[model samples]
Target: MECPYWLTSSQVGVYGRAAPEDFTADYEHWKRVVAQSYLNGIGISWSSVRNVMDMRAVYGGFAAALRDLNVWVMNVVSIDSPDTLPIIYERGLFGIYHNWCESFNTYPRSYDLLHADHIFSKTKKKCNLVAVIAEADRILRPEGKLIVRDDVETLGQVENMLRSMHWEIRMTYSKEKEGLLCAQKTMWRPKEMEIIKSAIA
Candidate 1:
């Protein structure tokens, strides 16, 4: 699907908002943290990972890090901006996908690891956070890991939602208004069944 808005330039943007300065440093820091979390927190090795998806990939920094580890990576951006696409391409991120976070075009059980950085804060304004979480659950393989980084305001709510969905919280780090959480999908609940359960109760 095409992006809802056009981004004219690549000026340190994330979650449809422009950063005050270059986001390279932030991206690099998160990349290392995420990798370390997967290794130490989640207890998963790089060789065990086959495919990964970055749900709100801005300039593909995280994807690049995974690629360096020889893992197949897919980066999805919500916007269809002309300016950002070229920069993503320039970074040699050819596997980039475009779609809304709450709705994706990928097949079910398509990824081993899914990453979302500051996506909840952004999508909470436009779509149902539960829908986005459900979609993430739907696309991830059983036992797949979901790594999320978001502002502190929504951390508790996000954690509760994931727990309600049967995800196992692996690690969580929160300081002031920023946090990172990693959880693993341990079970599957079909969408139809979820609706039925909701309707019946």
Candidate 2:
């Protein structure tokens, strides 16, 4: 299969091209941080994490790192194109699932931990931010954690939306144009509240 133009092209956009070695190194640093987050129960502990989803796993680096720690991981990409299949396979990323961020194919409460790296900034330009958050809320189990990294411009909006949903912000760090946040899903709302929300929708 031909590589997708987005992956192969030199045109700059939300996701710019990077040297493979540099990308790998960056991912490695994040992997350690995420692993520590889990181990330290930053939002939720490793013991609480049974299944994880890398919402925008490029080259499956984060997923691979979680797997090395004996965690069950499913790597998801926005596009289902064959462009990344060879790379996925080469990296031994066996648990791959494809779906757009705004809508996923997984069942409700499917994952204990969901990680997104620079995904919101890219998707927000193309999809509804509310839809993306709702989908993430649906798939995450109650008390499940979400770890996200994105540029400063998009991070504020994303943080506000998650806060509005009553998700507990567990940790946050920012440096220049980049930011990282971890949040945990709380209890379900009252049925009447859901009904009112549905009505509003």
RMSD of each: 6.0, 5.3
**Residues 1-201, model 2: lDDT tens digits:** 222334433433223454354345545765787567545645456776888888877666676666646577777766643344445566666545554543566754388898988778877776676677777887898899998889987878888988888899998888988988889889954355442242124
lDDT to native, each model: 0.69, 0.69
Q: Compute each candidate's TM-score over C-alphas.
A: 0.76, 0.76
Residue 2: error of model 2 in Å? 23
lDDT for position 82 in model 2: 30
lDDT of 1 by residue, 17-135 (tens): 45423345445765787577655675565677788988777666676666557787777766643344455566667555554533576764489898888777877776667777777
Model 1 residue pairs with clashes = 7-81, 152-177
Candidate 1 clashes: the total is: 2
